[model samples]
Target: MFRFLTAWIRSLSIRRIPMKIIVIGATGRVGSTVVSKLAARPDIEVYAGARHPEKVPAADNVTPFHIDLHDTKDDIKESLPEAGKLIFTAGSGGKDLLQVDLNGAVKIMKAAEEKGILRFVMLSSKGSLTPDLFSGKNPSPLANYLIAKYYADEWLMNNTHLQYTILQPTALVDKPGSGKVSLGNYTTNETSIENVAEVLIGLAEHNSSVGEIIEMSTGNEPIPEAINHLS
Candidate 1:
């Protein structure tokens, strides 16, 4: 397994990687973080999709557009335009998880497939795990959130076509990103959004991430260097 992993990493030495990203829910928590990371990298160009397109933050190489997942098919297409890949960082309204989390995601997937984009990354909660860490004890007091995440994960997994990576992140802390992380089927207590962004960046360049579900949390390690250990 180690040999196979190392060989896989070594094979990714190709020059000129294309990175045109369409970041859905870019104004949201994880979406914003992803946008910030891409802004700092010269190799990436990000399209920020938001409900209030004009409100999307202004940053280097970032383009904001109005895109409500509930909008009409033509409306969604108009906002998405051309992009190489997509990231879903949006949240479901209240406990209507199936409405947005499941259906919204499916709609987006179909749209991307029609537009010829193959890579997709999603930001979800760690609560989605089957033997949930907090299952025995009600952690958030709102179990439905986790329930929604579970369905979202299943939908992506059971579906076909796009190469997808599901990221189930730990507690979202308010620290400036250090870019280090710890990988586990379940996380401890908390982590910063910055560190999560670092992982998203790693996935952008990682082909092995296809069909994989990774859980992350803040660790003693630095954020930027966390993914280096993945190799």
Candidate 2:
């Protein structure tokens, strides 16, 4: 009986933790930060695809690859897989957010569909909902970009089978992370890129379906405390 108990315990402990995830735009400002945090975990299988794969931090577990968003679906398929989580943190590196954010993402989504990858997470900016209405043109300079993001977010929302979480951050700033955050519509008076990086890692580890569009702002939320608010 003791042997039986030991065997059962071992079985439970040995359950494989799934780590086959593709971190798109892994070389970007936020993506690189996320890469650093996940690299330490032995259980995670991270594919850090970037435009410049060589730029990724050297880590044993991270598999870096060249993933240019400008590539066609066929080209993208070669770099992507059929079933796994995909976190898109890549931007066009220009205001051409329309081509990079919307079109590039759509191409990836198409590849995922062919491969049957349904789980997804995205980093989006706030207030992108206006273009879907009668105004054929986007509202602001970045409106075209916003509309593109807004529509993509909407498609994910409509699809129930796919588990998705959309994080809409305020204007991204470069500062150290204090860790506390206020999940509200108001943009933070100040927001550090480090804090944003921390939050993205938190999202990856925690699994919750609180699928509301929460806006993050700069505040005095402590680091350990902000880490806890991921749910």
Candidate 3:
């Protein structure tokens, strides 16, 4: 098995080895952007993972991978490739957070660990670490969403063996991103889905981003620059 793994890694090498990055939920807004951005890069093989593979975008370096979050563990395992990195962008869109956000994420993490994937970048939302930020008279959905995220984040941090980065972005807007952001604790209205995608891709490539939970908002520095600082 070790020999097969070593040879497989070696076969992917050119002047430098190309890392395979699986972006789960590739049909979503942020996930699609991440796929587009990474698709043109020569150093990475982007597997655009989604339950509906037909909905995922087509690109030169991006391949559609069918991965159903609710599938049995063995089925889900078979759908994923033996890759070195994973970026989880899957969400239940408030429909079934308990199933998708918590259970599905944990299952994927376990699969990634078993496959010997070293890095994991999760596209999480803000307020996961601080639920009080969302508690108010209206009783926001963010409160419940954060509850699921908090436990998932905790499991990844404490239980998983993979190197991880959890990005907590504020309310997601579909506007064009400034490419600038406040990459830590901050107060802001909304962050462009583009910027969040950029940050997720940046952290995946940044070797030093492991174990960091970055809560961000629109700010003054470019995505790469801001991510470098964290590294």
Evaluated with lDDT, which candidate comes out highest?
3
lDDT by residue for model 1 (94-209), tens: 55576677667777777777777788887877767564643676555546777777766776777657888888787788788755577654445787887777787677667766
* Better candidate number, 1 or 3, judged by TM-score: 3
At residue 199, what lDDT does model 2 achieve? Answer: 67
lDDT (Cα atoms) of all candidates against the true structure: 0.75, 0.72, 0.87
Cand. 3 TM to true fold: 0.89
Off by over 4 Å in 1: 1-18, 72-74, 93-96, 131-140, 185-187, 222-231
RMSD of each: 8.0, 3.6, 5.6
Checking candidate 2 for backbone clashes, the offending pairs are 82-115, 180-221, 188-218
lDDT of 3 by residue, 171-229 (tens): 89999989899998665878999899888988998878798899899988888889889
Is 2 or 3 the stronger prediction by TM-score? 3
User: What lDDT score is found at residue 93 in candidate 3?
Assistant: 90
Lowest lDDT block of 10, candidate 3: 132-141
Better of 2 and 3 by lDDT: 3
How close to the true structure is residue 43 of candidate 1, measured as C-alpha lDDT? 80
**Candidate 2 per-residue C-alpha lDDT over 110-219 given as tens digits, one digit per residue, 9 for 90 to 100:** 77666776667777776655464425564465666677788777766674445676777777777777777755545465567777766666665556523655577777
The clash count for each model shown is: 6, 3, 0
